[model samples]
Target chain A: MTLTLEKSPLTEAAYYILLSLYEPMHGYGIMQNVKVMSSGRVNLGPGTLYGAISSLLEKGWIISAGESDSRKKEYQITEFGKKAVDCEIHRLEELLANGKKITGAKQ
Target chain B: MKHSTWRWISDYEKEEKWLNEMAAKGMSLYGFFMGKYTFEETEPGKYIYQIELLENFPTSPESVAYLRFLEDTGVICVASVFRWVYLRKEAASGPFELYTDIDSKIKRLSTMKNLWFTFVWLEFIIAAANLAMVIYGWLVVGQMAWFNLGCVVFLVILGLILLNFGLKPARKIKSLKREQLICE
Candidate 1:
């Protein structure tokens, strides 16, 4: 099935997960990076992290980088994932722009 | 010291809640087999437990890979029996949840509901066969049919119980899916 980028906005959890994968990182490293990058606002629980990784992998947004000696597998985002992030950023900017116009707030 | 207890439970929500309550009281899951849960004493509320229901048993290669992924995320697998996998992580490490978004939660619930309904249909088929056999035997065996009737009755009852067990999760899945659609 063709996935439409317009149907659903990127969730904060998914966005951060994709963001953390700009470099190859293992599962635990992804969780830690998400927590730090979100300024402690978003914490990806193991279950949530697992589901996100599986979904992204299935969507061809991420690929396995390799496995460490510890048997922990690492993942890195694909070009598709980078495009998805850009689309989300554009959508968010539109929302911000519309909100500022309505509130007559200068930024 | 290793401690063990057995519980016959099919409902996932109840089992997850009960296991977490046990963890809060210092008995954390160590392993499980059949209906027996093994625990090693740990600090109260030191661990958080999460359960996932799979369509196939845990021995499958897909399931093994899935569990390995969770382990890589720092979650420990405590036990797996049939289609249910029990997992726990130190509470101090962070939240012990596996699903943080509604979409993933909905997908998982749907998978479990489908599994339950498959069992219900299988039970239904057995019940139908039992009734047919009892009726056929009654026509041919004359007065020796009471035993067959008793057997058929027992099968029917068991089937009904299984049907109820299946329907509960099916209902929960429907409601959750509806809620998810509404949110969308």
Candidate 2:
């Protein structure tokens, strides 16, 4: 299935997970990085991360990196993942723009 | 010192909570088989426990790979009974949670509900078969198999118990679905 933002919006947990994968990290690293990137606002649980990684990998948005001699498997975001991220960013920008326009809120 | 205890907890969520409570009191669970729990002495509040209903038998390769992934996240698989895996991580390691969002929670609960529902139906069918055979022996045939009536009674009771077990998770899934709508 095409994981396009227009088709189905990304959950906050999923969005942060893909964002954290640009650095090619393992499971625990991804969880920690997501937590830090979101300023501790988003804590990705182990089970949720496992499920998201499996889905993202199946969707061709991420690829498993070669084993780094450690038991932990690493993953890196692919071009498809970047494309998905871009699509989501545009959608989010549109949401912000429309909300601000109506609320007369300052950036 | 190792401590062993037996507690039959039907609901996974309540079992997880009870295990965590035991961990907070310095009893870290290290083994579990069926309803028996084995714990080892540890520092108070040193660990957090989580239980999951696996999609297949825990010994299956699929579940093994899944558990390996969880281990990489600092959660170790302590034990498994059938499809139920018992996991724990040190409480010193920030915070540990198996599910962070409602979607995954709902999915897990649905899995549990479906499993119980299957068992309930299986038991119910067996009870019906036994009853039919008993009637056939008494009327259609010439033998008196009144003793089989007792077996049918036992199976029916077991099936009813399982039906009750299935309903708890079904209710949980229903509320979770409502929460999903509100969140969206």
Candidate 3:
């Protein structure tokens, strides 16, 4: 039997965060970048960022980089993270293409 | 009639003197000498001695002489001394009772609050990080389209997992919290 995979809707905030980590960024840097990127739509608290970072680490999507301080840890996305992003882009493209075709047909 | 026997031995010397005296009068000095003595005046003129043994008392002439002197002074030795092990079996139900009632209640409240706080905090951070990525992607790394896509996908997975975990039934979480609270 073929396994049916369900895709979830990406929250605007999460969508933008992954977008921020193209470079090696620390917690504070990530927070600042996200704020600027969203045009002040999302502000990440330290506690919240820490939790997300940990989750990302576990999922193997992000790997730890050299420490910024004794307390602060830096992270960068892994190859797997890059692949996931590619997949998401393809999915988004397919949806867009399908939408265009359907709308074009109606016209 | 119910009678109360309360002896205040303010001075250790006086208490020793009284114990020595009773031991001289054919009272097995073991009970009184070993800090296992219990006194209860069941009647107005009589006191019951139910002594327990914690350690071995010294049997020496000096101790015997002290006992003799006290016995000669008309102190009555009412009971025979018996040797027993003071078995201190703690009430098995005591800690469990504490755990279930006081410990469990406090733990549940604190844990629920903590879990909720953690869930909210995680959600916020994931949201914030995602926002940052978007802005940086647009401004700094417009050319790094591949990397930007990866970050988005990773975050989407993380968000879904977090939301699922946060929304899952909190019964197990509640129990774990209770356990931690009780232990503390």
Candidate whose DockQ is highest: 2
lDDT of 2 by residue, A1-94 (tens): 5553345788887788789888888988888898788888888888888888888888888899966568689999989898888888888999
- Model 1 lDDT tens row, A1-107: 23445446887778988999999989888888988887887777666677788888888888899986787898999888899999999899999999989888665
Give a tens-digit lDDT track for model 2, residues B55-76: 9898889898999898887889
lDDT of 3 by residue, A10-48 (tens): 334344556677688776678678878878766653333
Candidate 3 root-mean-square deviation in Å: 35.6
Tell me model 1's lDDT, rounded to 2 decimals.
0.80
Interface RMSD of each: 2.2, 1.3, 29.1
Model 2 CA deviation exceeding 4 Å by range: A1-6, A105-107, B142-144
Best by lDDT: 2
DockQ score of candidate 1? 0.61
| Candidate no. 2 TM-score | 0.92
* CAPRI band for model 1: medium
Candidate order by DockQ, decreasing, is: 2, 1, 3
* Cα lDDT of model 1 by residue, B68-164, tens digit: 8887776777888778888888888777778766777777777776776677677667767767777777677644456656766776777677677
DockQ of 3: 0.01
Name the candidate, 1 or 2, with the larger TM-score value: 2
Which model is ahead, 1 or 3, in terms of DockQ? 1
